[model samples]
Target: MLTLIQLILLLFWTSVGSAGAEKLYHRRDRSDVRIVHANQARVITDKHAAEVFLSRYGFIKPVNWEEAQFEGSASAFTDDFLEDFGDAVLEGSSQHPLRNPAWDGKDPDGASQSFISALEEFQRVSGLPVTGVFDGATKEAMNKPRCGVPDKEVDRNAAVDPESSSSASDTVNETDANRTATNSSVSADSFEDDAYHLNDTDGFDLKGHISNNTSVNGSHDGDMGNTSASTHQSQAGHRRKHHLATLISKNRQRRDVSERGYVAFSKRLLKWRLIGEGYSSQLTVEEQRYIFRLAFRMWSEVSPLEFVEDMRSPLEDVDIRLGFGTGRHLGCNQRFDGTGQEFAHAWFLGDIHFDDDEHFTAPNTGSGISLLKVAVHEIGHVLGLPHIYRSGSIMQPSYLPQESSFEMGWMDRKAIQHLYGGCNGRFSTVFDWIRKEKTPYGEVVVRFNTYFMRDGWYWLYENRNNRTRYGDPVTLQIGWHGLPKDGVDAYVHVWSRKRDTVYFFKGTRFWRYDSENDRVFTLDPEGRRYPRPISEGFPGVIGPIDTAFYDRRDSHIYFFKNALVYAFNVGANALARGFPKSIREVFPAVRRGDHPDGHIDAAYFSYTHGAVFLLKGSRFWRVAGSRERRRRLPLPRNGLLPHEEVGEQWFDICNVHPTALKLKR
Candidate 1:
C-alpha cells in the first residue's frame, strides 16, 4: 500500500513550485487514459472505494453512491472517483476557492481538453502526484477525505503505531491508510509544527509563495518530505490574514462613508436602503463614509436613531453614551442650517438630530419630520451638497424640513454631481458628488435657465439672430410672467408695448431672476450691443443660450429655453435699466454636407422661458421687438479655437452643435 507520506511526496514533486502548481485534468480532456493501476498506489478504485473513502474522513457530508458506476474496468473506478469528487466540491475544502485544484495552473485548455490538468490540480492540493494523469497516487489522495481532529486523537498513539495492530491493520491496504489519513486532521505537520497559530506570519508571500502551512514528511520519515519540500517548509511558520482594513473617521463634512469609520457604517446602511427603493443615488463609498463620521460626532446633541452596529456592544446601561458633553445628543455639536432652495444646512454630514418640540418647517426652521427623508437631505448637506433646483429632487427643499431623513430623487443626485462632478456613467453609478464654489447667478443670485455644462453651449456674448422684416414699429415694457402650462392669461407669453409674442411657450411655470448688475432697454432685440462692448460698468450684454464670454470685470452667463438661449444679465444693471437687451443666437442641427462650411449640428433650448422663435428649417429665435428687429452683429467664425478668449459682449457659441464652439464676432 502507498504510504500517505509517499503519496504526499509524489504530489509535491510533480506540482508544487515557485511558479504555482499546474492541474492534471480539465473537464474537457477525459477520453485519453484507458487503464490506470493504483492498487499498490493504495488508491482503491473498486466498487467499494467510495464507501471506504467516506468512512475515513468525517468532514462534510458522505457520498450517496447510489449512482456509482459499477461497470467497465479502471474506467468504472475513474468515474466513481470523479462522482465522489463532485461531492467534495459541494463541501468547501480547506484550500479555498483561490487555492482550489480546479483553479491551479496556466492551462490554455478547457474542461474537455484537460482532465490531466484537473488531475494535476487535484494532486497538488491533495498532496499527490500532479503528473497530469490519474496516477494511482492521485486516486489514493482523492480517496482521502478532509476531516477535523478530535481531542481523543490528540491522546492516541501515532497513526502508524505498529504496536496497536489488529485484524483491520492491513499494512499493504490502500483503503486503510486513506481512512486513517482523512480522519487524522493533523498531517504529521499540524500535529508537529511548533509555529502554527493565529500570530504566525511565515509563509506569507505577499509577492511570492504558493499557499501557507502544508503537511510534509521529514528526513527520517518517508516520501511526503520531498514534495514541494521547500514551499511547505517555508509556509510552516506563517499565519493566514484577511484583507479588510480599519475604516476612518472624518470631521470635515463630505458625502463618502468609508472615511468616517463608525459614522461611515451608518451612511452606507442608509445608501443601501435608498438603493433598495427605486431612488437614484449619487454618493460613493468614500463620500458616504465622510458624512457618516460627522453624523456620528453630531449624533451626540441630537439622537435621531440609536448607534447600534450589530447585536453586540455594551447594553448594560441603557443610557450610557460615549465622548464628551451630554444632554442626549451626547454633547456632539449641531452646527449649520440652510437658507433657500439653493442650499440646505446641516450640523454634521452623518449624524441624525431631531426636536420633539413644536411644529417647525425648513431651509430656515423646524425639526420634527420624516426621519428617512430629512436624514437623506441633511445627510447631503453634511456632505457639502448645495441645493438642486430640479422639482423632483430630494434636496429641492420642497419637503417638510423637520423630517430626520428625506427621500432620494433623480434631481438631487444630479445637483450633487454638478458640484463634485461624477464618473459620467449611467446616472445610477454616481455617488457622493463634489461641487466647487461657482455661482452662476447675481447679487441676489440667478442661475441660468439651465446649466451650460462642460459643454460650451453658453460660451459667447452676442450671437444675434437674423432679422425678419414683419409687423409695425412700437415700443413698450417687456417682461414675462412665467411659462405655466395651464390656460393662463399673459403667463406663458412674452409681451412688449409693440405686439406680445409667445416664443418659448411650452411647459412649467418658474421664477424670474437677473444677475448682480446688468440690465437695459432697447427698441431692437438683436441689432444693438447696449453700452456697446465698450461699456464695462454698464449692463454687459445679453445673448442667446450657449454663449460664453471672457471678462475680467463681470460674470458672463447665458440663457436658453428650447434651443440654446444665453442671457447676459448683471442684476444691478437690470434693477437700474428698464429692460435688458435680449439677443437670439440660433444654430440648427445640420447633416453632413448640409452646410459646405461644416457648421451647425443641433439646437439646444431650456424648458423655462416663454419665447421660442424658429428662424427657418434650421434656425429659430425668440421673436420679439418690432417685425423689423435687425440682427446687426457680424456673423461668427463657425467654431471655437484653441487660444481664443470670448469678449464679455462678443462671445462664442456652437453655431451648429453643442460640442462645437462658434465665435460670434
Candidate 2:
C-alpha cells in the first residue's frame, strides 16, 4: 500500500501527464479542422457529380455528353453546367477548349484518357491518392473550402519542382553554419527556424498579359452524364502512355522560363483602398480597413514595397482596390458561388473581391474564416504569386485552420523577394540604448533597446521580437525631445562605476541626455551648457565625426571620421595614446578587400550579440566579439565579418507612407 503523500504525488503526476496529452490532442484536432465555413459544397455522391466537379475546375475539357459515353452511369448533361464551366475557366484562361464549343466533342477518348489523367493530376496536387477513380477520400477533398483560384491553370505549361532550386542548398548550408557558429552566443528567439523551400529560378513575370479585367473564379455545379463502357475500355490502353507523356513534357518544360510566369506591379510604392461601396457587412468599416492595412503591412515587412491606404483617391488611381460582395457583386466580370467552396478571387496585378456570403471574421476568432489570411493570400496574387502547394505556405490553395501566431513563412518571403527584392535602406545612426529599471518585485534589471535613425525619423527595434515596433519611423523630435529635427549622426552611451552618461552627436554639436528625465540636458552636472562642441567634450577628437560608439571592454569611445578612427579615453577626458588609426587597421576585414574602407555611417555595439557592427549604405559588417575569442579560433580580434545586407540581419525596418506615419498600434 502507498503512503498518503505518495498517493497525492501520483495523482498530481497523472493529471500533469493527462494535461500534456490533451494539449497535443488539441493541436491535432485544430489542424484537422481545415474547412472554415459550415456550408461548403456537399460531398460528391456519384460518378456524374465527380465528373462535373473535375470538369469545372479545369480537369477534363468540357465534355459533349450527347456525343460521348463512359463506363459509369449515364445521366443527362445540362447546358447550364457547360455555360458555368466555360465562364469559370475563361476568367483565367482564354485558350480553354470550352471557350470554343465546336472543339468540345473532337477528342473521342476524352471520357477515358483525358478524364483519368485529369483526375490523377487533381489528386496529386490535392494531396490525395491518385487512384484515378471517384473514391470517398477524393469526394471529401473536393468538398473542402478552398481559394477561388484554380488548382491547375489550363494555360500553365510546366510545373517547377521546388526541391530542384539552387537556393535550397544555399539556404540550408548558411542556416547550418550560422547555427553552429552562434550557438553559444545567440538565443533561439533571434533566429527564425521555420523553413519553406522555394524555386529560385522561378520569377514572377509582370510583363505578360496585362488584362484590365481578368479574374480567377472558383465554384461548384450540378452533375453531368457519363460515357459508355466501350469508350473507357477502348482508351485504357492509351492511359499509361498519355500520363507518362504528360509528366515528361511537364518535367522537360519546368526549366523553360517562358512556361513559368506570373504578374506583379511595376512600381514599389503602391496605393490601395477598401472601396466604400463594397465594404463588408459582417465587420465594421474600421475593422475591415484595419484588417486590410495589416495584410498589406505584412507584405511590406518582408519586401521593399510599401502600401498606403488611399481613401480619397480616384478608384482608377489606386493601384489595388479591395471589396466584398455576394453573387454578381463589385462590378467584377465573374460571379461568386454563394457561400460554398469558393470564397474569393483576385485579378492578377488588379483588384480583389471577397465573397460576402462567406463567414469572414477577424484573426484568432477560432471559428470563422480569417479575413486577414484571405486578404494576405489574395494580395499575394495581385502582387503575382501563384498557388504554392507546400505545407505552411500562405499561398496554398486551401485554407488551413487559423493559427493564432500565424506569420508569413520563409518560403513566402523568398517568393515575394524574388519579385521585388529585399528591403534596403540607409541609416543615419544605429545604437543600443541601455537603461536600469526596477521591477514590481523590487529587483533591479538592466534593459536595452536598439534604435535606427534615418533623416528625421527613428525606429525602435524590439530585439527580443526580432522586428521593429509596429508603426515606427516616428520623427526624432517626438522620440527624443529637444533633439535636432533633422536627426543625429551618432549616439554613445558611456557607462562605468563612477560615470554613466549618454550623448547624441550631429554636425559639430553634441547634446547630453538625462535618462531619468528623458530629454536633452540644458546644463549637465559638470556645469556644461547645452550643444557643446566636440573639441570641448573630448580635446583631441575632431568635430563632425562620421559615427561613434563606446566600447565597454576597453572603456574607450571610438569615433570614425573619414578614413581614421580616434579612440578617446573617457576617464582621462582625452584621446588615448596612439589614438588615430586607419579604419582598416582598427577593423580589418576577414575577407581580403571586402572592407567598408571609408565614410562609415554608424558604429554600433549591440548588447544582444555582444559585437560591434559597422553600417554603411545598405550593408553592415560585424566585428569579432568575445564569443569568437572564446572559441580559440585563428580569427583576428576585432576583424570584420563578411558584409551582409542590413535588411537581412535586421528585418522589417521599412518606411511607411508619409500619410500613415502616425498609424495606430
Candidate 3:
C-alpha cells in the first residue's frame, strides 16, 4: 500500500475516517508526480508519512489508540511513542542497538524494565551513562519528531492498491487529548508544499472521492517496499505493533517562538537517516579529534529521541555525548613516534584517547593518519561493532591508518546495520501519556532498566590464560566453568558490553551416553561418572553435554563440544532456581561466548572499558570504549598475544590460586 511512500506530504489537512475501513486500498500512478488541484488525488498525508518514516528508523506504528493502551504502561512516555518504539526494540534486539527486553509482550513491570533497558542501551551506544534514568543526555538522544516544511500548497495526488484498502485518517482516531485538535486551530500555512513538491500544471482528479468531499482511503494504498508498514500494528491491540498513543486534555500549551521553523526543520532531518562520519581511519591526536567531531555531528541526526514519560508529554528528547580524545595509552602516548605497541581506546562509560606523539608531519602539517586507528577500532568494539575477519576496517584489530576508516564498502554498511541498527531514520509517532504514577520518582515512568556487574567482580589475569583476553569491551571473564557431572566436560565463561556473558565449550572429562541405547557409560579410565553414563535419569542426558545459563533474560543451555545451543522459556517456576532448565528451545552449531573468534577477550563482567586478553604473540591487549565516565589508559606492550594459540585460551580464572578480574569504572 506504501509503494509510492516516498511521495509523502507532511501535515496536510484531511477529513477523518470513511466506510471503506477494509476491502479497499490506494494505488499510485508514477506519471502523477505533478501537482494537482484541490480535487485531485490526496497527497501522501503527513500523518501517514510520519507513521511510515518513524518505523523506518527502527520503530513501530500502532493500529489504534486502544491497541496502544494495551501494550504500554504507566511508565510509557506515550502510547503512540511506545507502540512504535516497541516494534524497533523487539525487531532490532539481536543487534542490541537498543536494550533487549524479553520478547514476550507481558508483565507490565517487565515491559517497563525493557523500556528502561532500551534507554540505557541507547545511552551506552551513544556514549552516555548506563544509569537507567532518563537524564539530560538521554532526553537529547530521544528527541526525534516527525515534521517537515514545503514551499508550496498540498493537494491529493495519486493511488495504487493491494487487495484491501485503508485510510490514513481511518486509523487516526482522536484520543481524548487529540480530540482537542478537532476543535483546535492548526497553522495550515505551516504545511509547506513548495519545498518538496512544486505547484505545477500536472493536475489530475483523485478516485472521484471529491464529490463526497471525503478524505482519501489510505487503507487502499498498501504495496511495494513499505518497511515502515511491516513494523505497524494491524489492529490497535495487535501484538505486531506497540505504539504509544494518548489523548490529552485541552490544557496542552502551544509554542511561542515564531522563528522556530529552522528548529523544526532540523528536528525533521533525523527521521530521514542517521547520518554520521563513516568508520575512522588512523590519524594523529589533533586529526582524530577533528574527524571524531565530524563523525559525531553526522551521527546526531535532526530528531532528538522522544518519549512520554509520565513526567512529560510526547516531546522530542536528544541525548548523546559529543567529544574526542586520543586513546593513547601512557606507554603509547610517550609523546614520540612509534614507541609503543598500542594507539588509542574508548571505554563504555564515555572515555576516549589518542597518541600524543603520533602527529601530522611538519611543513603545513595537517591531517595525518591516526596513531590509534586501533583506538577507534576499540571504541567500535564498545559500541557493539565486532572485529572484522578482514585485515582492514577500523573494526579489524590489525588494520592501520593507510586503510581509511571513512571509506566504508557495502559490506561495512550491511555489517553496521546488522550490528548497531538500521541506519535509516524512519519516524513513527505515538501519543505516550506519561502520567503521574506512584512509587519512587512519581512523574518519570521508567519503561526500561539495566545493571552491569560491580567493580572487582573479576580480577585481571595473573597468568597465561588471563593474558589472552583483552581488547575493546569493558572487561572479559570466565564466570562459570566445570566438568559434566555425567561425564568429562569443560566450559569457558565470558562477559562484556560488546557481547555479555557466554560459555564456550572445551572438552568433556571422559564419559557420556550411548547414542543408540540412551544408556550411561563410564568412559573415563576410572569408570566413575568420568567413564560417565551414556544417558541420564529423567532429568539428565549424556555425551557432549551443554551448559545451563542463568539470567532473567533469555538464558540458555548449550553444549560446546557438540556446538549446540538450547534456549529455555523459563516460566515463573524457574525464577527461584539459580539456573533455569531447558523446558524448550534448540540451537546447533551455534558457537557462542564473549566472542565467536576474537583474538583476545576480557572480563566475565566488565564495567565500562579496559578488557584484558592475551594475543597471538603472547601479548596482552587492553580494549575499551569511552563514555561520560571512564578515563583512557595506554595499551600494555606486547600484551596482545600468548606464546602459542591455546597457550592458555580460557584463562585459568576460577582455578587460579588467587584473584581473577576487577573493573576500573
> What's model 3's lDDT at 453?
17
Q: TM-score of every model?
A: 0.19, 0.63, 0.18
Candidates in order have lDDT scores of 0.26, 0.68, 0.27
* Model 1 C-alpha lDDT versus the unseen true structure: 0.26
| Top-scoring candidate (TM-score) | 2
Model 1, range 167-251, lDDT digits (tens) per residue?
A: 1121111122222211112211111233221111111111111111112121122244344544643332121110000000122
- Model 3: per-residue Cα lDDT over 1-665, one tens digit each: 54444334321212223333342212243321333342222222222232222232212211111122222333334446566443333221232211223222222343244344444433443456788564566554443211111111112111122111123223323233222111111111221333211111122332332112111122222353556555463442332222222211110111111132211111212111111222223344345444443333222211121111021322222111222223312221112113232243332212234433333221122345443233334434323233343323444333444333343333333343332233121111001111223566565442211111112122233232222123111221333123232221222222223332222222322323332232334442334443323233102324434333222223323222233333322232122333222211221111222222221121111222223222222222222223211342342221222122222232212211111112110
Candidate 3 TM-score over all chains jointly = 0.18
Q: Estimate, for each residue in 1-665, the C-alpha lDDT of model 2 and write its tens digit.
A: 99999999999999888873332212333442234343344445555556667765545532111101111111212333343233223223433333433343343334465667667766876788888876778878877777775443322212233343332112211112122111011100111223322311112221121111111122235322344433553243234224333332322222223211422355778889898899898999999998888888778866778898887977767878899988767655456776757778875556788998888998888977889888989998777666676678798877764656667776777777765666678898999888889999999999888999998888899888777775576878888998999989999999988889999999988999998788999999888898999898889988899999999899999999999999999889999999799999988888999999989999998888878999999999999886886685778889998999998788778776655555542
Instruction: Tell me how far the alpha carbon of residue 81 in candidate 2 is from the true structure, in angstroms, after superposition.
Output: 21
In model 2, which runs have C-alpha deviations exceeding 4 angstroms? 1-141, 154-263, 275-277, 281-287, 310-317, 359-370, 389-392, 400-405, 437-449, 456-486, 512-536, 540-542, 578-585, 588-593, 624-642
Whichever of 1 and 2 has more TM-score, that candidate is 2
Task: Single out the weakest 10-residue window by summed lDDT for candidate 2.
Answer: 181-190
Q: Which ten residues in a row have the lowest lDDT in candidate 1?
A: 239-248
Off by over 4 Å in 1: 1-419, 422-502, 505-636, 640-665
Best by lDDT: 2
